[model samples]
Target: MKTRQFFASLAAASILLAVPAFAADSAQAFVDKAAIGGKFEVDSSQIALGKVQDQSIKDFAQMMIRDHGAANAKLATVAGEQKLKVPSALDAQHQGDLDKLKNAQAPIDPAYVDMQRKAHADAVKLFETYASGGDNAGLKTFAQQTVDTLKTHQQMIEKIAAGQDAITGATTPAVKTDNTPNAAALVPGANSFTEAQAKSRIEGAGYTNVSKLTKDDQGIWRGHATKAGEGLAVGLDYQGNVVAASK
Candidate 1:
């Protein structure tokens, strides 16, 4: 009976010793799967950003490659010790993004900033979801760590898009000359036409048949009107509240 109890005790000790190996193997398997997924994701981004013309995007892509690639290598070492396998390629959605970015290599429109912003936004969402919901503890931890990085990237990309919009919106047409005075060169002084000066000058002028108005290359205000039988050009001095009459 003593021998029988001794045998059972040894069996339990063996099982306890084996438990750690099993756990280690399971942890490695989970980490391996995650690394595989991350590898493809990083590869897609590297190729996509490589085609971008923006220096910022290109620099960021280089960073992603270095960081994620290092993490993948580390994971491979861990997985190998536990006899686990990592996936060798990306999924369909990532492939699609890669293709789109590649095709946009030519010209590389500034509007591509919008595409980058959206992509980062989606990535943040995906990483956050997986980090919280993944079955493996190691994978979940890795994902959680990755989520912070992805969210930061999303914010940066959004700022880039906003900058592009501001640049586009602030653009104004170049001023063109049409016998109009170069009003842009005029310095505002005591004799300059203020809002009140302009309003008073136009109101008091006995101008008739005024069809078009413009400034001249010499900082003179010119107006066109049908006078008598032909178009006559007249200059007005809003600063003096008077018309210089056609000269």
Candidate 2:
């Protein structure tokens, strides 16, 4: 009777141990999927850099590359500490998306913008779920922090999509013909410029009241500026192009 009781107690302890192990396995699965998603965003955006002709689309793609690349690096470090393995390649679904982007025969800007909208929407959902109740404590915190950035990206992409739709419907050329040089050409390799340096460059270009300077996910410096007493929204792209849109 004593031996039988002892064996029963040991089996109960073993089951108790198995429970946490199962939870850890679940956490590992989330980590893997999250990592893959980040990689997909970075890779797809890189492809857009070469294929997109629209400056706005290119700017959006640059932001994806910068933001996703940073997030992926942080995630890799977190996963490493927990002994979870992250896959370097995209899964089948993401690969399919990439293929479509590469082979798109339609105007590339709309196609790319549409894809970004869908992708970010799904990403926001995924991060929200994991952040709210995932088993991994460390990764849960990471997810919560990252959800804000994901939402921001979503909002930006939505605006881009709407603007692109309007541009597509218009009959006139997107920009009037002028002798002005491309603003992007002025600062070659502008991505390397610090925020202060970028601000100086904007000021040098005859913009005043430069305030609310913030770097968006695409490594662009955006803020409010005034040229001849008119308020304007302006952005400096990674390649040093100063793009201004009238308010």
- Model 2 TM: 0.64
Q: Cα RMSDs of all predictions?
A: 16.4, 11.0
Q: What clash pairs does model 1 have?
A: 180-215, 180-216, 180-217, 181-215, 181-216, 181-217, 182-216, 182-217
Error in Å for residue 106 of model 2? 7.5
Per-residue CA lDDT of candidate 2, range 86-163, in tens? Answer: 888889998998999888763466677877898898889988998998888888998998999999999888866654
- Per-model CA lDDT versus the true structure: 0.53, 0.74
Candidate 2: pairs in clash? 63-217, 63-218, 184-241
Q: How high is the lDDT of residue 11 in model 1?
A: 100
lDDT of residue 143 for candidate 1: 65
Cα error of candidate 1 at position 188, Å = 23
